[model samples]
Target: MNNRWLLPEYIEDVLPEAAWQVEDVRAKLLSLFKSYGYELVIPPHVEYIESLTGIEGDDLNLKTFKLVDQITGRQLGLRADMTPQVARIDAHLLNRMDVTRLCYAGHVVHTLPAGHFSTREPLQVGAEIYGSKNLTADIEIIELMSSALKVAGISEMNVDIGHVGIFRTICELAKASPQIVDQLFTALQTKDLPSIAELTINWEESLKVAVLALPSLFGEAESVLATARLKLPTVPAIQDALETIERVCVHLATIGVRCSVELGELRTGFYHNGLVFTAFAKGWSNPVARGGRYDNIGQQFGRARAATGFSIDLRDILRGLSTPSGKMSILAPDSQEPELRELIAKLRESGEIVRVDISGGSSDELAWDRKIVKSVNGWEVVSK
Candidate 1:
């Protein structure tokens, strides 16, 4: 008897059914993006560490898998997020002075969280709209996100939307010292309210109560308005930010994009400015997709471009829902190899996703077919 455990914490071994579902979601997203005039851009998973920096903030620096590139003797890191890579493409490679819409489906790696549902590696599908700061761009991204989820057959998924500026506005209004702001940020990250309250204990009663209520201010649009009604009276900056969020929400509702408004939802990178959101599905604790506007990052690379994008964690979504079975048959050529090649090519062009059989005889072909059929369970195979 041999017992071997061969797997790491964050890495995953997805079986056939779930893997097919993941692929299905990726295909649907890609198709939708293409229809919207967004061209595909596939960035390398490995990049110079400096390239990924200044976009994700400290989170990227901490979770990135780093290695010394023997070829160039420079440090390279596995991309933890696709946004920065996309930014680099827009600013340095394409040199498209105008706004460019790019879409991608790829894998990203990060350090695994302890005892959490987070995967160290995940397949992501997303799109970026560059060189546009208009609110229409924001609405369009959210609309596409919802449509993509609908195409994936994922219903009841809620979008929790907020702006980074709103959170920062509150921090400043509280007159929070750098240390206190850092502590409040930590509490915000963990959704810890008690720590926030303790920090504002010495403040005036009204200010202290508003500061403590930050974590609980997350819910529907009306809930955000209700919370803002209280805190905004004392802090003019926060009040103005809240009004902006309310306007964005009203616009979203008018467009029939239904999302629960969350005032304090603020887990984002340094690049975000106008709006940020996370899409949640049933049976998944963490958000399956996250996106927002990041205007400053492109400027850091000297482009001064305004851009926004979101990424879907394919692994998390596959874990939450099942997709239809994909049955593929490898048709072997009986005597005419070219004819069979033509048939395979036609099937591929039609998007049927077929493969050509390469076994020597019928028996060998049948044996190979049986293995796949049995493993996939629902897959059917026929050989001529």
Candidate 2:
């Protein structure tokens, strides 16, 4: 056998049954988004490196699969995420000054598996709304994600929300050195108190206290907000971030999507400058869906539109779930008669799948629910 027959690690084909389930979920999500006025757009699988992963997306740059374009002799990158592509569309393609809601579903190739249970290739499905920075816009996106989860049959979910502005504000106030900032950020993300204490040890008393206290600021929305208000530096940017979270949480509660506030979280989308969110379904350790506000992401495309959206790994969504059933077929005897062909056509048009039995039929190999039999009244449906 050829050595190439064995595929590389973390990459594999999506077989029929699982592919069907992923497609089913994708269709349901897109349909739901359409009903809410989000239009669909398809971006190329690859593009020039710079346009695909924006400037501040250094983290994403590491995740992207880059290659030299043979035709243009320029470097191109397969998208690891679709957010930048959608932002480009909003900024350049549509060029809409008004608020735009766009949805897309496609395969994205990552240099490595995203996390546990993730493949190098995943079908990413998501929606993005641009040209708005209001907290209501964030709430709407979260609601949309919740609606998709409910449709996917996820009954229980937890939304852990956060804001990067909190850290940004603290950094600005402390005028922290690069080392201290990096250490503090890493500690906060991982909730490593010792690392935080060690990093900020040489810092001034007030700044050190604030940085060290950051990790303990995660919990229920109201309580976290109350504590954060007192513990965090009282800067305008930080206050605005807190207020935005408060309003979004309150609005979500009214819609029954209540979430706990996570002050220390900086989602993998490092460019996220404002509110961020990740959703956990019952029985799953990782988030089923994630997104946040990366307001200036579009400026890389030469337009600054406030953007927020959420994306789900279609493969992840189907994991630990039963494969979706494909269309059931009706067994019919092969015939050239006009009446039989007409009947088959009618059945197919009416949304029934009918498979004609040929000379070498494999009844033992395949199971069909019903068979067509001829009666005085014409073809009749009979139990198999």
- Model 2 CA lDDT for position 251: 80
Candidate 2 stretches with Cα past 4 Å from truth are: 1-3, 177-183
For residues 205-299, write the lDDT of model 1, one tens digit per residue: 76666656666777888777776686643566566667766777787687666677665666756567668888887778877777988886776
| Whole-model lDDT values for every prediction | 0.73, 0.84
Candidate 2 weakest lDDT stretch, 10 residues: 359-368
Residues 1-384, candidate 2, lDDT per residue (tens digit)?
A: 669778878888888777777777789989999999999999999999998776563668888999999999999999999999999999988999899999999999998887887789988999989999877788889999999988876877888889887887777777887666766676787888888878767767877787777777788999989988887777788888899989888887888875888888886477788889999887665688999888878898889899999998877777757776666778888877778888889988998888888845576444478888889988877888
Clashes of each: 0, 0
